[model samples]
Target: MQFTTRPTLSGTFGMVSSTHWLASQSAMAVLEDGGNAYDAAVAGAFVLHVVEPHLNGPAGEVPILLAPADGEVRVLCGQGVAPAGATVAHYKGLGLDLVPGTGPLAAAVPGAFDAWLLLLRDHGTKSLADVLKYAIGYAEHGHAPVERVGETVETVRELFETEWTSSAEIYLPDGHPPRPGELLRNPALAATWQRLLAETAGAGDREAEIDAAREVWRSGFIAEALVRQAGRPTLDTSGERHTGTLTAADLAGWSAHYEAPATYDWNGWTLCKAGPWSQGPVLLQQLALLPPELPAQGSADYVHLLVEGCKLAMADREAWYGDADGADRVPLDDLLSPEYNAQRRRLVGDKASFELRPGAPGGRTPRLSAHALVAAVEGEGLDALG
Candidate 1:
């Protein structure tokens, strides 16, 4: 078996691993300071916003799964909903068939801030000030910038300069991307957090303090800034610049909530994942359809089987998955049933199938998105196996 270059370290206290080393350190600091897992996660997440802005930002959304030491596993629905003005009709009015991958039109209600705060307030043992200290410090005093951050900034330098001037002001210092290992400061974001912190001064208790911070984030300068900037056109991948529809009212109206996880039992291990609204259930369904016994890891057969299984699962996802509360929601119960999986398992063959096969549940017809249909048409004859 192949071994990792760095061996796993055993610890009785705790362990925190993130995409960035500084984020891991920030979480570890929380743990060392006697904070619980939720507190540590919140701290790490905020640090990630400052240090890995290229990957994720404060305005981005995140789907979190939290498993407490004694409590049941829960899903924190941090994936923000579309703003009130964001509708199929609205995008079509803009002459857009698809939402542009970047810029204003692509923005959703910023959920990460509220979600993290909710987790901290409800489950954490520490105060908001304590959890946020590391993030604020890093953003204010500066941290060593990663190579990828610099590379992404450099790649988008022209776009920033020409259209996204606000972005250029933050990313390009002295008209150039900051070099890797250089100290990078985001005083604006740091000040934003600090202002939120300042709002907690006269609160009654820890919970109240957190609540005050959430209110500030939703209705204060952050919301005002988003509302102002979203009204202006920005460049996007669709080769067109567009303005956003998100409003301050949208931010004020939204809050993160917890929900039960979708679970499936396989070989005495129960796997839990977010609902069909996410791609999580597709993974569970794929695992359910796999053979009880499998070939050796890293073997060609093993890789081929995994890939084929993924394709089959993804086809169903494209056809059936949508908002859980919607009329056309996936029938997850029937999809995961033993009888249904047994029937589906029979379709897996020695050779991979190029066809898209989506199972029908209780005679309900699958709903495929327009994007999927276009891809299916354009992807013909491009199949690697052919």
Candidate 2:
């Protein structure tokens, strides 16, 4: 939550809840105890695991970008990536358009806890035990389920909740989400956290804790627990004979990468982001393409223009966006460049709408298709057909 190139006397904290406030307070406790932003973030994320498991958890990906006072911005990609054996064609063969959530096979290499530990080792002021105490306490003792969460689960019908009994049993108990005031507990997750603590104890003070936690997280327990919770054995790992090459080792091999994010200057704000995976620049493309001033009335026309621009951008994203290290980095900037937007904007008009024929590569529209000839003599259209 803290962002700055140079250390100042103060900073701001952002949150949207009674619970986030509690987590922030814990983080602020770390800060007040002389911990750095890295330490605060680590503490906060762990707290979120217990308090905000719906949105995030040890079982989920959590990519982060940290900019400290060092003048260099560091990005930690906490988002999990598909296992080495996984590929686009692999899922297609599994009769899937997209891998479903928190599933065993869809489980990416979880690197958040490790990354947090690492950041602390190098920059943290508090010890590993100190940062984790709050979270561990919450996990072991338990807390009441937040009100809004149960509503969301019911609203979604947990429709995509995956039919496995282990998963269903835990979530759909009695065919319903836990009522808002219900006592929420996760002793298994707590046990895992404790093991991480023990493993990290012997390692070098704080940083090594991160490395140790990584190993614990990557252990077979991850797959086992997921299987137990999901209430089923692992799904077929061998995707079509050729597509799914993922062995369990592939899961262990995947890790989050670190890199610098891209930045742009727009509307006086210093727009910052990372490429390929990040969704920022695509939004800027739609914004820049619009006329500098707003339309007289926010009518269907204005909405239509935005959607059309989004369609073009989304098509480009699906076709090209991917892991930069593992795949080709598309010429993403080209799509949002001022020159490109200007040309595309020129195609728009204030009058009646026009249909645009999208074409193949090189951004060119294909010529209209030829039609069968049905020649007719002057004033003899019907006779000619006969």
Q: What are the lDDT figures for the candidates, one per model?
A: 0.84, 0.59
lDDT of 1 by residue, 38-82 (tens): 999999999999999999977888788999888899998787888
Model 2 poorest 10 in a row by lDDT:
367-376
lDDT of 1: 0.84
Candidate 2 residue spans exceeding 4 A from truth: 1-19, 92-102, 152-176, 219-247, 290-312, 326-328, 347-386
Candidate 1, which segments miss by more than 4 Å at Cα?
380-386
Model 2: pairs clashing at backbone N, Cα or C within 3 Å: 63-78, 85-246, 121-207, 166-229, 166-231, 167-229, 167-230
**For model 2, what is the error of residue 384's alpha carbon versus the real structure, in angstroms, after optimal superposition?**
38
* Per-model TM-score on C-alpha atoms: 0.94, 0.72
Candidate 1 backbone clash number: 0
